[model samples]
Target chain A: MTLATPPVGEPRHRRGSPRGTGAFDRSRRRLYLPFVVPALVLYLAFVIGPTLAALWISFHRWDGVSDMRWNGLDNYSALFDDPTFRTALANTLIILVVAGAAIFAISFVLTMIVREMRGRSFIRSVLFFPHIVSAIVLSIVWGFIFEHNGTVNTILSTVFGTEPIPWLNADNLFLMILIGTVWISTGLYVTIILAAVDRIPRYFYEEALLAGANAYQRLRFVTLPLSWDVISVAAIFWTISSLKIFEFIYAFGGTTNDMPPPAVWNSALFVYGESFGGRSPSYLFGYASASAILMLVLFTALIVVLRRLLRRDSIEF
Target chain B: MQMRYRRRRVRAAALTLTVTLGLFGAACSADDSGGGSAQQFTYWSMWQEKEPQAKVLAKALADFEKESGIKVKVEWQGRDNVTKLLAALRTDDVPDLIDQQYFTVSNAIVKNDQFKDLSDVHDMEIPGESKTVRQVIPEKYDQFTTTANGAQFLIPYEVIGYSIWYDAKTLPDVADNPPKTWQEFADVLARSKASGRNPIALDGDIAGYAEFWTATALSRTLGPGGFYKLVSDKQASGWNNPGVRNALAAIASLAKQKYFIPGYDSSKFPAIQTKWAQNQADFLYMGSWAPTETGTLAAPGFKYRSFNFPTFGSDESLPASVIGFAVPKSADHAEAAQKFIAHFLHKERLSKISSEANNLTPRSDVEVPEQLEDVNELLQEKKLSKITDGVLGDFSDFDKKVFQPLNLQLMTGKITPDEFIDQITTGQRDFWAGHRS
Candidate 1:
């Protein structure tokens, strides 16, 4: 009787057809090539073309202005041997894995709590606010909160009589940045997971409860399974976004004309520091390009591996 | 029915493509229409549009336009001028005149042989002045004028001298009698610390700013000539120089005494500077630009003052550099650019630059603003030293790799004086080895 049932008496293809389904399908198939050509041309011209160009440039020694000289593999070898690049790579990975894990775990906890709260919508809106704000503005606010003579220090001195903490020191800067990253990213994941969790029927939770399943058990047996697909997609998204984090760290220089100290540099900062950065730019185009390509390759591999690991069959209600 | 639907869909797609292609073509044609008349000359200034220098230069350019009956298109590109210039040099859209810091041009762009010879501008009359451009500027700036190939590449305009700045309202005694000896300076710092205050407020976020303390100490201890020799000489044992050790030890002692303000190593740029302006800190080591740079954030009645870093029984030579204009080799209007430079150097225009821009004009005859009287006096005294004592002058890489990192560690008390020197010398030796190979 339903539209999906395709009426009981008609053949499968013709049942739903108001205007000759077979002929319409054939015509649509004929239109696909012409319809797709423009988009494919654009994609090739903008995305794939520049990517291949970057790969070609990565093999040369160029200052961006002068003639490019071919020096195959030398840039790659130099990158691995460079201590600054190593630090940048390590920082980027730490941001990707460590900050990412914290974001997911915290977001999951927040989702669980917000799901049962009376003012759930209000809480979700508040949590989502930081994500929508500019990263540069967020970084500036974060800096002021943690500065020595800033608000936190003022509160500590007056209320607790505690000495000020050096929250943004070289030893502590990357850690502070990681914590800020977690704060900013948790909201988006929470919203995503909440949306996935909301799709589950109320009867599923009621049945779990009647069967003597506790809240944690229900989360494991009901909520998590239903949301697994969305969680996997979110994981891949986080992996890519975390690698491109530059503005949040770059703004820490706070009116400085030069790039931030190398201690907190990520791959993006590394690429910039090598070319068209600093008071006097080094402009090592080939070196910067090689680093960029390395990041692309690493991110591509990570995304693929993540998809494989987080893959799950959809659960139908 | 199928044929009608197919025809409609194909028409819609064709319409969308046509619209997109039309928009793109419009954009391309709009960009292509930017070429101006042949009588126009373009200038790209390195100052932001709102900066005092940019305003003064715009007015001078306007005056030149009126006098010469030539149209000049000025672009305020700020710090992006260097990058844009490099890119534009490869194309026909290159600017006729580009303003840049002398050190930046000499260090980054000069070796590329892109700048035209500016020797003719040296003898050009300074508009209505009886003096030629060369006669007004001191011979000391000649160091920046001539490129490695012995061709003049820059016309020095706005000069900057670096020194230790302090809030006069807070430290009237130190301001009255700025310490002239290292021992005296240390005593002042010790006294300031003993009175429950930090002596120095450093924005250690900028490693180069932190390096100033060590550079000044080395300059004083080794003298300018000795400091240059130590930096330029390729000897593996450059760090073994007694002056280098003494300078590091002196910086370490300040750290040992906890003379820097709390969280000095971790504080962001302008935060420490802001605190210094607020009279919360005793002294700040910065360039002459500090006053104008921090003017908006300074507390009420804040009197900004500066003095040369105290010496160790040697002549004081404060760090100095010049920011100026140069014509590119491919410029189509080199004569117009030269005329602009000559007009810019006129005594009347230079005086306005000094007064309105809060800049130290290179011309000795122009009177500096009251805020920069101290810097002008030092310049008149001929006490300005090359930046970093001219150390790392020939080796620009050493500033980023060797000097800044080592200086930051030293400032943070993360590394000892001995460790600082060892790391620097090792870095220098490795750098030379790589270059030689």
Candidate 2:
């Protein structure tokens, strides 16, 4: 009927065509690759392009208002010796290790509880609500809370009779920032992990149960392996985000207004303060650009390493 | 299950807001009274505050609208006042009148050449207000109003002063008065600490609060004009200068003194308002602006007064850094704006501003509001109410460059006075060289 279907072993498409489909397959190409160009353009313009420009600017010094001077790694050289920069780097690492670990572990446990819930959607929204609010707005709100005579201390003094702690001190500045960040962002991860947990079929659990596998055994064998890919992706995201932690810290603590947030100046706040924290020198925006470049490098390295550890064979379940 | 699930997405938020169209409609009543020249001029104020000062100004505008037959439509944009003026400068359609930050007068001149020199206008105005303008403003503020090219930028709007604000109730039974000298001041604070009260309730997050106390105190010690030269000169930015080092060391010594309220740098500025409100701390060295409602300093039963900050070095030569406002050159309704400027300085309007929350008016015609104790005392000096550091005139970019960094260094204990002066000089030299090119 169709010339015997081009024989059993014959190709369905031309050699160069994907899935053996020809280039003339207009409708199929239109349906599939329509999304590709837009996504590519978005990634190029916003992500890849700005990154390269930031890298270029990092070598020079320019205040946002003035002309640029190509310092040729002078900013980088200065950054290495700069106490503020060192503090920021250490702070970023501490946040990544602490918040990253906590967010993931908590998300897993919460997902386990939430997955078996009756009001699953309601619980999911509650967890994810903070993620919808902008970090800057949230930080401002938190600032009111942690402010010297804020509500937190008012309650503490009234209820437990504790004195107000130096919540925004150099010693605990990063900790307050971390606590705020964790509260706002962990919900998104929990939701992601929950979705992954949902996709694992009940059949696997039933089969495991018949095999006399307990809840812990069923979870380890069925849930953990199935959700490993999603959990790994979440970790990679948290790593990148932790490296560029700016809005919360920047809004939470101002260098002029607040003690430079325990000198744990994430590179974002570091460059920002250098550019315009009231005492900025002649607009060496070039140097700010340079710090941005270095941050990109650091973030890229983190992503690469995480990919190596979390990288795995695409599961065939 | 499906019905229950569907209801979650369709639910309304908790707070139910009534539209109240009737109330809103009543609030939008139009005024049509006219007495004189029906000049419909547009005006703008930088502050969108709900304070009575704004309301009084609005009433005056309405009165002016009734008297002059000039309906002033004001578009108020609220945010950082100076930043808004800078944005207003880059456009052609600007309001006829503007109320902007006092420091912006310099940039206003450089950005646009459209401003009608108020001095020229001052000379042209009727003889009645001229004497008032001349008498109220000191020579220093006159210098500030003059442009780089030497023209009056704008009339004085408001004057601010800063000093140590103390809870009068918390004064120990032993100490009779606020300290007059740096050592006495330190001792008084130590006494306060010994008495189980925070000696200083400075903000935790701001470096400026600390800098203000130490700098003002040091200026009192360092011959009257010493700190003024530091602000105007460029070489003093390095932490190497002796005075710069002295200032930082002084502040650092205070920081280490343990008499400062705990969490000094981490506490937000307004939170200090509460600390003082709750009588948790004794002294707050803040702006004269604090007496205003905008500072939110006045809580119910709020009792406080200002004293001259205890001095380390005397500075008779420089005035306290005061903030004011000016309309920029790109103003659309320049004549109406001029009228508004004049209105702001008029005796009744100025008095209203001064009386409301006890704000200071630079107009010599008006007496100091009774609520402000410091200015009332300073008014007694009558040694020409000198404006802040640039009252004589604004400095070039280089001049600002020279001192800004040194000021930071001085605050941080990172540099000495000699180094600070040297940096100022170097910064000035660099700025001068750049200008020459």
Candidate 3:
């Protein structure tokens, strides 16, 4: 007992020897480079390469047929002056902030209600079915349901004796699109958050319940705290996916076989409307590329800010 | 454990085998087209295989091949044929013959100087007829056939244009004496509204269709080629032109009167037009294709007829859209393609465009389809102008970005005529400034 001894708390192998600089560690490290280099090369070639190319192309004026001419910042500067582009940018942000807020709120409520419900799996599947269907199909069906003479109006007329409403008109079109985005996207986030919530030990909820915590208090303390990481990831996921939502809104043109009006267009549609779309193709590759670059930069910054704001220390159950 | 390993191996092997076979099949089916042969020319048609136009063309092509001892390989590409053709232009396997709306070909192929000079094509005699290609097609269509470079880039075939359509059975007075002036047309609309019927059926969702009110007005106020000058003015001074204000007033007056059917702005395309075809509305300003498109949906005994846009000036500039063929500058078998154009231009062959396809042919001698007779007569009676003053072909983006939105507001009663002018001027100035470099 009196004899000097190595500290019991200390790891024996790490006492004098380097932790990760050993011959075996060095060899294992060498294996990672070979394993990752191929994937790195592919990612750089396809993703990074195109991103740089788009940036480069954004500075020039090109119709995609003739040689590109340099017009530094003109394409980007022109975007602000463009009313359609402004509307598109505004619509995109509204979808991101407004629709996103709605989707998360509804998803959480659904998850909380479904958590203790009977036949939860079947209910979850029913909620998730719209997410699995094609956006084009969903948009078409949604449009038909809210059309002037469609289901909602028909019901209102017969039941309440209300006059038909113009749901798909210009003033209301963007609002309908926002509502649609929420309806279509909520289920996915619900499934994800529910999965994350399910991972928490059941004992935590039982403990909260035993402590005289109400349902809301239990969700606020036990459920939400545990699901923060997934919720954050889902928020970031929605930010990215929402920007790429084209088919749903594009299909809402509703048999006109034309792009929807500029008033309702989002950034995704802005890119398409400026190039390779409509009966008369614009082919404004440079301008469209510029808009694409702006969208990318703005969203990338948003994701970074979002990540910082949502960061939390992982809690051990 | 050995059995499990064997089963896993079998599964992996099956997947590998299936992937290999899939890759092979994809490679085999990649492309079947070959380089042009000595006496064969390839054609990429804009008609779908099952369409009436394609049927007529198929029969004509077969007969041409039998007669000339030259084969024509055709791909039945649909409406997006020009888009496909443009992509193929970069490759070695370019189609020898291509066809599309004249303005479409003008904007894409002709604008880029990719079309062969077809001024000689006009003089080329039809295969079994004494008349030349130019002789068969009306001289008036010559306005849209040539490019700015003075090259006859397109050979006119099908002629389409905007007209004020109506059911003759419902509106006998309109059918008997079609309105020839803007005042008279407005009177007709007022009268129709008073009789407890909606006057006009507009698919307000279609900007082009909605813009008809303004475009026709401009065509009337600004005489021949005035609309083009108004649109293409680099200084953006065209909006100040009195004619622009005049055109705006016409549409503004219509919107103010609520002459359009209720909920017209929100009603989807084909819905409003189909209702008009079913005689729910008295009039619809649409293209010549209106009748053929709505023939099935039309109420029984619906006599489809149309009148030219009512005049505001002495010179009546009627809108005409030509759908035709063009040979690419780099075509492999240009001679055969040119020869086929001549053979197909024959009266007998061209007549099928009207008889079978329910379309108007540039050859006035061809018997007019029942639905298209009124428009054909109007084209002959009025001074023909390129549809939308050919501005859609040259400044399509400007129209979409700057003009169409403002035009929509003007037609929808969202903005006053003066507000539209002011806003359009600012929009045009901004647009050109960005594009000037």
On TM-score, the leading prediction is: 1
lDDT of 2: 0.60
True contacts kept of 1: 0.31
**CA error at residue B243 for candidate 3, angstroms:** 3.9
Query: On residues A185-277, what C-alpha lDDT tens digit does candidate 1 reach at each position?
Result: 899899999999989888888888899998789888888888888899999999999999988888864344677777788999988887767
Task: Choose 1 or 2, whichever is better by lDDT.
Answer: 1
Interface DockQ of each model: 0.34, 0.18, 0.29
Give the runs in model 3 whose Cα sits over 4 Å from its true position: A1-49, A254-256, B1-33
Highest DockQ: which candidate?
Answer: 1
The candidate, 1 or 3, that scores higher on DockQ is: 1
- Model 2 lDDT per residue over B386-431, tens place: 2323312234233223333345444434565555556556655555
TM-score of each: 0.91, 0.72, 0.90
- Candidate with the larger TM-score of 2 and 3: 3
Full-model lDDT for every candidate? 0.81, 0.60, 0.84
Candidate 3 per-residue lDDT, tens place, B1-437, comes to 77556655655665566566557757765655676376999999999999999999999999999999999999998877777777677666678899988878877777667889888888899989998987887778878888765789889888887899999999999998999998999999999999999899888877777866787788678887887788777777978777678778988988899888876777667778888998888889887899989999999999998998888878576788889989988888988999999999999999999899988888878998888888988877777887777777778788877777788888879999999988888888778876732
